[model samples]
Target: MIIESYSFGRMKVDGIGFDSDLIIFPEKIVSSWWRVQGHYLQVRDLGEVLDYQPEVLVIGTGYSGCMDVADEVKKELEAAGIKYYIEKSSRAVEIFNKIDSKKKVGAFHLTC
Candidate 1:
């Protein structure tokens, strides 16, 4: 990954961005407040990084983890047969780390 920028609590990987405080795994992120800044989960983009079919996609919605993903995107993931997991950032990070060592995973996260 081309990490283009990094600061006290944030980083920009290639064009994908994230916050350091958030925990991330192969498939999910525990917190993703940074997504509001015009960065988000793009399946095709992620697919390029994974280089294979990912079993799941996880999103960490920040604080309460309340964020509504676009319906079309959700449907696309379903069509691709990728599972979706949405949760608070902390828990999402934990799950990501656990599964990352075993298989294909992608994570995006941002912190409060």
Candidate 2:
């Protein structure tokens, strides 16, 4: 899928706009995604992406990077051998645009 645009609290992917947290998979977009702790991220919040077995997982930690990705979550991803990245939304968008993995996923927190 192609990300057409991204701005505070919103993003456009493959011609569809999303105003909430979302998971972008190679073949589909999961909208209205919510985390267990609102602004905190955990492995349990990413069950769908994990089950997809992506080659890479890029995390967008919100517009101003307010969301916190837990250490234990990182450890779990590492254990699963999934290459992952955590960055502020803007930077993460750049990284996501550059990746060419056949099986890649992105979990994006649209706003802070």
Candidate 3:
């Protein structure tokens, strides 16, 4: 589903522009306890929103980029048979768009 617009606490996301600290693709109702910047938060939030655990989770860490994917989260995903790709914001967007369009995968992207 196309996300027309959304506002979450200090974050604001719209199709045309973003006024948020982050943007979650394929926007949908989210659980309140899911924290955006918290450690291991992306996987938790995406799991809540998508309703189904994914085979892969791609994380776009902020501008400077972060290579460390939390070991615990990685273990959980791996145990659940989920692969992960962690990269900078720009590359994450490209990868997400490609997989989303081709395989109809579900993705949650957060960017600054």
Candidate 4:
């Protein structure tokens, strides 16, 4: 999926607008994604992404980078051989758009 644009609490993906947090996979988009602990990103929060076995994972940690990605999550992704990028939502949008991998997934927190 192509992420067309991203703002504070909204994102445009594949020409469609979504106001909720989302996970963008190669073949589909999962909307309204909520973490188990709200602003904290745990490994459990990424079950779907892990199951998909993407070569790369991109995380957008809200507009002001309010979200926290657990270190265990990073280590697990590393153990699974998954490359990852973590950044504030706006910059994450830029990074996501530049990547050319089909086996890539993006989980984004749209708001702070």
Number of backbone-clashing residue pairs for each candidate, in the order shown: 7, 0, 0, 0
Candidates in descending TM-score order: 4, 2, 3, 1
* Candidate maximizing TM-score: 4
Cα lDDT tens digits, model 1, 23-73, are 334444444323333334443434442444567666655445544455666
lDDT (C-alpha, whole model) for all candidates: 0.50, 0.92, 0.46, 0.95
lDDT by residue (tens digit), candidate 2, 1-112: 7678889999999899999999999888999999999999988999998888888999999999999999998998999899999999999998998999889899999998
Q: What is the lDDT of residue 98 in candidate 3?
A: 58
The residue ranges of model 4 lying beyond 4 angstroms of the native Cα positions read none
Model 3, CA-based lDDT: 0.46
TM-score of each: 0.51, 0.97, 0.55, 0.98
For residue 34, give model 2's deviation from the true position in Å: 0.2
- Candidate 4 lands at a TM-score of 0.98
lDDT of 1 at 14: 45
TM-score winner between 1 and 2, please give it.
Answer: 2
Clashes of 4: 0
Pairs that collide, model 4: none
Off by over 4 Å in 2: none
lDDT of prediction 1: 0.50
Worst 10 residues of 3 by lDDT: 101-110
Model 4 agreement with the true structure over 28-99: per-residue lDDT tens digits: 999999999999999999999999999999999999999999999999999999999999999999999899
